[model samples]
Target: MTGSLQPVLAGVVTALVGFASSFTVVLAGLRAVGATDTQASSGLLAVCVLSGASAVWLGLRHRLPISIAWSTPGAALLVATGPVAGGWPAAVGAFVVSGLLIVAAGLFPPLSRAVAAIPKPIAAAMLAGVLLPLCTAPVRALVEVPALAGPVVLVWLLLHRYARRWAVPGALAVAVVAIALTAPPARPGSAGLWPVLDPTVPSLSLSALVGLAVPLFLVTMAAQNVPGMAVLTGYGYRPPFGSALRVTGLASAVAAPVGGHAVNLAAITAALAAGPDAHPDPDRRWIASVTAGVGLALLGLGAGVATTLVLLSPPVLIEAVAGLALVGALAGALAAALAEPDAREAAVVTFVVTAAGVSLLGVGGAFWGLLAGGLMLLLFRRPRPATAPAPEDGGTVAGAATPRQPGRRPGRRGVPAGR
Candidate 1:
């Protein structure tokens, strides 16, 4: 009984930490892409429930600690991309398309391989570029609203040094207190406390498909799903890649009309459930993930309240917490983007182009950054020279002078080659 309770508690912690740390980012992204307050709330509820459902299903079926989450990086990408040409409906359409693409990648080996074939440096560079602006929000918040943002930053710093896992949640708690003190009080029954689904009729557009859908898909795959598989594998679990993709993709599609962007496997938080900390016996760890799923679904009931608080708080204050949560991600992405010395130049170009936030022909910076980096790599790649034929029997060709030793020179004396 005690052993069973331990995983349940760990699962509770995982759910609370995961939701508190980055839900602000999700709301901000939906708002950025033209979702209204109500829509954003509904979107948040939808994703929490859907992702939790998927996690529970996968954990029970595979008996592995297969955690699932809404694509936080993909949300950041939406914030960076801003509003699409045809407004929120178009963005919804794009979400549907991205979900279908994920399904296709699972079903079609060639499509999955094609996405995987993208150069690592370029992919990491693009993600870093997308994340750069959001990661800077903490400092900006401090400068802009010192009293409100200072306490949040200070708590985050101190807790980060000691209880690293709880740093963001600690900051979020402070931010909430700060908001309650300064923000205007809500009237009785102003915000819904229950989960509600508000659906939109999706409208497709070429611009949204290219600018929003493609980048969203790429970011979710590279930043969330791929790393999630790695995390599970590191814990000695065989991740059901195809099934997971299909589940998440289908969930994303179903939830998009309700404003949820995307759902994928959890990367950072997966460690909490899959690691030994969740359970001493590896076989029983799936219980932690299952409990986490249920806990997350329960948390979805508070989406309306969370959205109300965000709506009332100073935008930068909420952004500061989200930004702090992403700083580690930005650092990891930047490190990966520059890891290969040979690809450094191309990677930098990708980073610069993406970070520029420029749009061309209705396509966003991410796609263009990849194109520019690929071009740079192709254009600058140097071919290896052909090896010279070996001399037969170690004999020199006719009229060829004897080769000098490395320490000997041509000037009739034993001189160093450098000299």
Candidate 2:
């Protein structure tokens, strides 16, 4: 019973963090991309439903801790992309394309391989740039609303230094308390329960396809799915990669017209369920993920309440909390980007160009950053020469004919003794 309880607790903890920690960023992203409050709520609910279901299904089917989640980076991409020429409807169309692309990639191993072929440094750098701005929310909010932001930052700093895992949620708690204590009470009727689906009839445009859809697909694939798989693999749990993509891709399409972006495998939250805290027996850990799914599904049904709390908060404060959540991720991405000497220059180029937020031909900086970085890699990457074959025990290089002894076989590394 104690053993069973541990996984259950871990699952609940993960779902709480998964839902509360980054939900604001998801809300902010939807709003930034022109979603109305109701539409945003609906979309959030939609994502929660799909992701939760996927988590449960995959976790149970494979007996692996296969947690699923919305692409926070993709949401960041949507935020950065802003509105499209055809507005929200066009953006929805782009989401559909991205969803289909993910589905297609799952169906075609070559496409998945191609996505995986993207250099790690460039991918890390691009992610860093996307997350960099969000991580600054705390600092920016400190200047704009010190009273509210100060306590939030202080809590985050303290928790980050000590508890680590609770840092973001703890800081968020502080922010909420600070707001409650300091801000004037909301006027009557300022908030209400509204969950309407303002469905968009998706319309495609060249600008949207190139600028939004393609970049969105790349961001979701490179930043979310690839690393996500790495996390799952790290946990000693392997699921069919193509199937996961298909599930998420189809889920994305289902959620798109309503408002949500994309759903994929969990990243930060994966560690919570995948690690030892979830269960001692790796075999039983699937229960943790399933538990997380059930919790998320319940939360999704109440997404309006979750979204409303965020809606009622000060935008800067929300940003600060969201940014605080991403600080660790941003730091990790930066370290990866600068780790390799051969990739450093290209990585830096990618980071700067992405951070600069430059757009060309309607496409966002992320695409351009990757393109520039890839080009830089071509010019700067040094090709390592083929390794020399090791000498055999017989004192000759591998595959070299050496002096033959009666019935003597090729020695170590397939080399015969003295020619």
The best candidate by TM-score is 1
lDDT accuracy of residue 383 in candidate 2 = 96
List candidate 2 segments past 4 Å from native: 182-191, 387-419
**Pairing residues by index, what is the TM-score of model 1?**
0.89
For every model shown, what is its TM-score relative to the native structure? 0.89, 0.88
Residue 253 shift from truth in candidate 2, angstroms: 1.1
**Cα RMSD for candidates in order:** 14.0, 10.3
The residue-by-residue lDDT of candidate 1 on 204-289, one tens digit each, is 99989999899889888878877776566555555677888888999999989999999988877888887778988778888999
The digit string of per-residue lDDT tens for model 2 on 154-272 reads 88889889998788889888877776676556632122454445687888978888877887787788767766665555544445678888888999988898887888878778778
Instruction: Report the error of model 1 at residue 183, Å.
Output: 0.9
Show pairs that collide, candidate 1. none
Q: Clashes in model 2: which pairs?
A: 402-417, 402-418, 402-419, 403-417, 403-418, 403-419
Whole-model lDDT per candidate: 0.83, 0.76
